[model samples]
Target: MALHLFSSIRGHRNQINALSRVVARGEPGHAYLFEGPEGIGKDTVAQALLARLACLDAAPQAADACGACRSCAALLRGEHPDLVRLARDGATIKIDQVRSALGRLRFDPVLGRVKGLLVESADLLREEAANALLKTLEEPPSRTVFVLVSSKPQLLLETIRSRCQVLRFSDLSPDDVAALLVAEGVAPDAARVAAALAEGSMHRARSLCDPARMALNDEVARFALALGTAPPTDAAAWIEQIAERRATLAQAQGADSDNAEADEEPAARTGKTALTREDLQWLLDVLRAVLRDVVLCGTGIDAASLPHARHAAALHAMANRCDIGRIVAVVDACQQLEQRMGINPNPRLALSALLVEAGLRLRAT
Candidate 1:
């Protein structure tokens, strides 16, 4: 299917309108930097703008592309010669890739009025590659447009950022995310749950829709409840169980299990599978949501208003056993741990520590 029109995108109305106005005026900028949280439709908006610019039958005041036009069809088939897409080769966009892409961007448009270049995850450009790209941005070709998409715009070189017209995108509301999921044929109940846990990321919400991820969420919810209600002495046992389950699930899904090299850290050489940083983060996110629900239950909020509404009974149990202050403390600790996760080398150990800390706080209350 063809890419959705700008009008069809869920959020970023302001950004879309801004781009539409620029296109309508026939003075679109040569380079744009779309910076925002991942999976929040920045790239989608960029593509929509490019489509509008390329459409042959689009009216002067049109807010979207003419989907039936030749240019639009070429885009739909991913055969548009005028559009060049550059993404990281593996870990970074190498100098060679940037050189080649720059060479392509120099060519005249085959069909569309303007040539287009899209650099996905633009922050992954290596130092030399970024310098090469900056040179192109400095002396951009006529009738050409460049869209650089990045979630970590701060990592991009300051000089590179200054040359482009930067557009910032914000997170989508849960309602908007759920609506989009429903439109994509997800069940309403599942969509609402996924959206609530997604933290404004459509990619995360979609992943949460998978049966395996949903099952993992259930386990996390149970673990959260256990932290509140289980005997303090049983904390270690339950934490270990959950950690083992997580490791097993990761293995079942073909996680990173290559034998460690001699120079690797001790944690890697243990020959035992463990939770990754991503796995720990996922656990923390679900735990935070459940804890938030517990706080809501304590404050007499309606069950339906809870993010984990289906776990309202367990949340209430947790809330009744623990006071608001302790629950809040646990939540704060989770947030801090998440913020520090980038430097932490051992995710399984981190998860254990978090669970133990949560148990102590909740048991004290």
Candidate 2:
């Protein structure tokens, strides 16, 4: 497939500059950890580098391989002998795949000066895969460059990490993200939500750029907002939808959605229940956003000051009823819940306990 490049995120100026510098110097390293969240365009940057390296043209800019050259076109078409991409077919990049890729990496480029091995989602590397790739990283073939992309650097072993140059990618500013999304044909409201929900990852915004997730997020946001006003209202309908979403995401992994009737509480049965785990976590995320606005509000900043300030005005208004410190605690608790999502059961109970704990703290003063 031809590389579908995106207009780079604006704040990635330093990354782009650094990539250009690497290409200009013809000094691409043996190993690099392009560490950043999903959708931040690490893949795009890496491809641009590959294009520069693989371009058949050995003109003055041969080092920054011309995009139109035969080698660059071959890379774009996924036919470049020098360009190798090893991505996890699923959740994990296994040892066998790594060994096979390493075997292939030993070969010279049929069309270019260098061999480029791109490992997408390096975090999924099994320990053995990491070890298998280590020797090559330590003693790479001449003109061979290894680029590994990861959203979760913490999951990688430090020894392997120690051998590679680390490049960190950050979340983009909301305005930058919004502009990018809008440019991609996202509606204004969609651009706003995708940027906010994306939390700085362009892949996330683009992947979730779908109408269903956006609509779901809107419902979840609206429901979370409603909870601030009255806890005893039609929370059931909202939670049922959240459970369905949780099941959907889980099912995508081939996990069974065994949400038996007994798993629900008395209140849940009546459609007036507390939040589900998914619902609670999403609420906490929204609450965190709300509290952020509170912090901004307390600082005398305008409600429109945030990345999602337009969508955050009501959240800021809700924040007026919360203490900053309390909001911090709320965020901490939400993080805890996020970390504990798979481990916890009885989603409704977890949500209720979390809410009670947060309510006691928020309503304390």
Model number with the top TM-score:
1
lDDT of 2 by residue, 1-365 (tens): 24433233356778877876777677778888899877677776777666666666646433345567677678667777677788885568899998888787677777777778888888889888988888788788888888888877898888878888999988888777888889989877678767766677676577556676665666655544443454444443545657677447535633432222112243322124334454555555665554555566656777665644545666666567766676677667767777876666655566556655655566523
Off by over 4 Å in 2: 1-10, 58-65, 206-208, 220-276, 287-365
Candidate 2 lDDT score at position 140: 82
Q: Candidate 2, after superposition: displacement of residue 228 in Å? A: 8.0
Query: What is the lDDT of every predicted structure here?
Result: 0.79, 0.67
Cα displacement (Å) at residue 140, model 1:
2.1
lDDT of 1: 0.79
TM-score of each: 0.79, 0.68
Q: State how far residue 223 of model 1 sits from its true place (Å).
A: 3.7
C-alpha root-mean-square deviation, candidate 1: 5.0
